[model samples]
Target: MNNKLIRQAQEALIVLGYLSGTADGKFDKSTQDAVLRFRRAEGLKRTNIISQPLMPYFEAATLKKLQTNLKTLGYANGVTGKLDKATIAAIKTYQKNNKLRQSGEYSHVLLAKTNRAAREREQARNRRAPVSVQNNIGTSSRSNDVVISSRNIPSQSNSSKASAMPNLNNRTVQENEIMRSEPNTAIQGKMRILKGSNGQVTGCKISTITISSDWCTSGNNKEGSQCNVLYKNGRVLSVRCR
Candidate 1:
């Protein structure tokens, strides 16, 4: 028997919530029951055997379901339907916070534990005082205070007030002019370019700040290239040849 194939099948089953324990590559009774459940769900032959051709089906289904669950639990931002770097990072963070093994991989145990945590948090929130009751209490307290009329209040002369207030419009225009005149000096020197798994230039890092691909416009930039980085809003915006 191919232990590797069995392990993969077990992991897929665990991710789909059919199994509850770790995938130990052993065809135990629990694994067999999980496989039987999965077969019934997919309308396949009611057998516990995981064939070589069934690997792709299991992988695709498991990844999509895992991504959906991770996103719903707030562990991931968006579901790209693929196991990308962001998804792995979210998984690792979730596992670390939950005191799990921190494997940064998907499993039924992780999902089940996270679901329970979410339910506990929701119950705790529901036990708190409602916002409407707090607002009513504040309103009741303020009702006993005296009301003041704007017409009875003293007012300053328009001429005096106009002279004291500075020309805010002109000041704003001057500040904008100064900002436009200033040179872009967020990144003074060259920084190292970074790439993704597809060998495309994604972003760069200077010192300690790591810029992401969304903030970078990599025009003819390559990985490991020392390029002049344009910075904006506390991030690297673009990379160009000096």
Candidate 2:
């Protein structure tokens, strides 16, 4: 099988919203989540393998998701899902980070970043051992490692928003963007703050990364987004939110 072709196919899934993770091309747990969600949404058997039968729908969805994210990050000037220069640039920047690749090609790094983006989200759920969640965390600015602690949940004394660290990526704050709070159910002294683009926790500045399980989340035009998390299944893959 042509790994390049397979990687391209996987990139289609990431761009179109069929999957949310690194486009690393290895098709790890996060990719599985996106596929299952797409399959379940399409009334097909949810399988791990991306086969020939499901290629068309997968491609369409991947393009859409890619367009959305690229646009959100100010990369895709075009609304269409076509891989224009703008979109490629956005993917390249993303590739440089979360996926952590030196090559410019859309090899495994892109696939991995798009797919594994949600894997780091477990930090929002698990409070006891914050390091547990960072194990598979990506290197994206937003993928900044979070350590959910029972003590860090939003409170009058700490909910000052500024009390939560600032997003040092120099990313302009969306004026209307509401800062989300970590769950109040955290245990005492458990670190429960979101990481920033600086790779440090300023205050619990919860960005969209807290929305899903990080790279574990997957999206598709048709099925929306899904996760690879074991959840109750004894697995730990997560999914991105749409």
Return the top candidate by lDDT: 1
lDDT string, candidate 1, 152-235, tens digits: 112223444442323333321100000111134444334555555533334455433344432232233333445565543222
Clashes per model (N, Cα, C within 3 A): 0, 61
Residues 1-242, candidate 2: write the lDDT tens digits.
35665576667666546666556777667777777777887688867667776776665555655555443332333446566665666666665555455344443335445434433333433422121221222333444334232222212233335534333343322111111122322211211333346322222122232322122212321122321212211112332223
- lDDT for each of the candidates? 0.52, 0.41
Q: Which stretches in model 2 have alpha-carbon errors above 4 Å?
A: 1-53, 66-79, 98-109, 118-242
- Candidate 1, position 4, lDDT: 92
Q: Report the C-alpha displacement of residue 96, candidate 1, in angstroms.
A: 9.5
Best candidate per TM-score, number?
1
lDDT of 2 at 100: 54
lDDT of 2: 0.41
